[model samples]
Target: MNLETHEPVAENLGVLEIAALLRELTAALLDIADFDEALTRLVTVAQRTVPGVTWCGFTALRAGEPAGVAASDPRLAELDDLGHGAESPAMSAVHRREMVLSTDLAAEERWPDWTARACALGVRSVVAAPVDIDDHVIGALNLYADAPDALTARRQLTAMLLAEHAGLLLAGVRGREQRTALTNEIDETLLQEGVIGQAIGVIMTQRGCPAPEALQVLRSAALALSIPLREVAERLVVTVSRSRGA
Candidate 1:
């Protein structure tokens, strides 16, 4: 195998070789926990496994615009930014929810401006495959090469398979992140409620009032002070602690 190009020295990859490549990809990404880190790892894997790929990047749609989310190299990130518009292969793949291939940027007529800019940046061939998560077209995986026609049929297939795997992994990462955030939010809410309950009890004892009347007084104080109920409750609790200590 040619390490630089990641291609077989004498022939295309056999079935076993392809299986090995897939196993490598799965092993590399299975342990990632963060969404951004997963995307970074994905691009790194693309550069190592895709034949003739000199650079790799991931682009995500934000507010209906393409944004470079990750890259195997810093230069690839800059290259991804150039494709933010409709003329870029990454944008096209995301919009069409399919793969877009440019065999030679110099001879490409479909996106003249993008081709010109890519060529100037030493990108001669490109493959962009849409990444889908839960039936939604979320972004694109881009493979770039410095030699014309380098992203051949086999390379395109590899890119597509990688994109599919990335989508599944990213979806799991996102779900876990969301669950963690929700758990934290719930804990915070419960803590705040406990503080408010303590404040209400303090008010009841100090003013010789019922629980409902104490709560009403606290609400009135919060309204007059133009502060949140939680803030007022926290302040009251802290003041009582200080007074008891003194």
Candidate 2:
């Protein structure tokens, strides 16, 4: 297959060839453990596999705002930044939930400023495919080419396939990160509760009071000192331990 031209290599790719390509993509991305690394790998793979793709980038929503997450080259990230406006092809794909293509930046009228800047960076043609990470998170896979009419139907199809795979992999990575964060939070909460329980027990023994009364005394001390309940409990436990050691 001619990797530089927009012409279709064949009427349709053979089933075996499609499967092989998919296998290659899966192998390349499956072992990635970090979300940012996975996004970086995705753009790298797109640049490697897509025809006429001089540079590639991935942009996604971060903390409710769109940001450039990864790029095959640093320049591509700069191009992505220019693509945040309403007329930008990348943001258009994300907003329209479809593919957006610009055959020639010189002739492009919708995004004059963006095209001017992209042309200055040697990008003449571009394609952007929406990557749906989840119901809530949508991203764009942007492909840039140095020549006009570089992104044909066949090339766009390849870009879309890569974007679909990226969505799945990124979603899995994000899910794992969220789960790990939740598990850590739970563990910290349990540990704090245990410390507080121990502190309450100490107060109960020293004051000859029930658990509720001991807890109230601990709260009163925390309020008076203007410290957190957890800090108060930790200090009391440490003080008691040191006294016993002495």
TM-score of each: 0.68, 0.68
Residues 109-137 of candidate 2: C-alpha lDDT, one tens digit per residue: 97787788789888999988888887656
Best-matching candidate per lDDT: 2
- Candidate 1: deviation at residue 213, Å? 37
Q: Which stretches of candidate 1 lie over 4 Å from their true place?
A: 1-13, 82-84, 135-137, 193-246
Clashing pairs in 1: none
Clashing pairs in 2: none
Candidate 1 lDDT, 1-246, residue by residue in tens: 112245553464456656776777777767665677777887887788766899998887645655337888886575567444466888778777788888888889987777877788889989888887543327888899999988776677677767887788777766776786886675455444788889988998899997667777888999999999889999999999999999
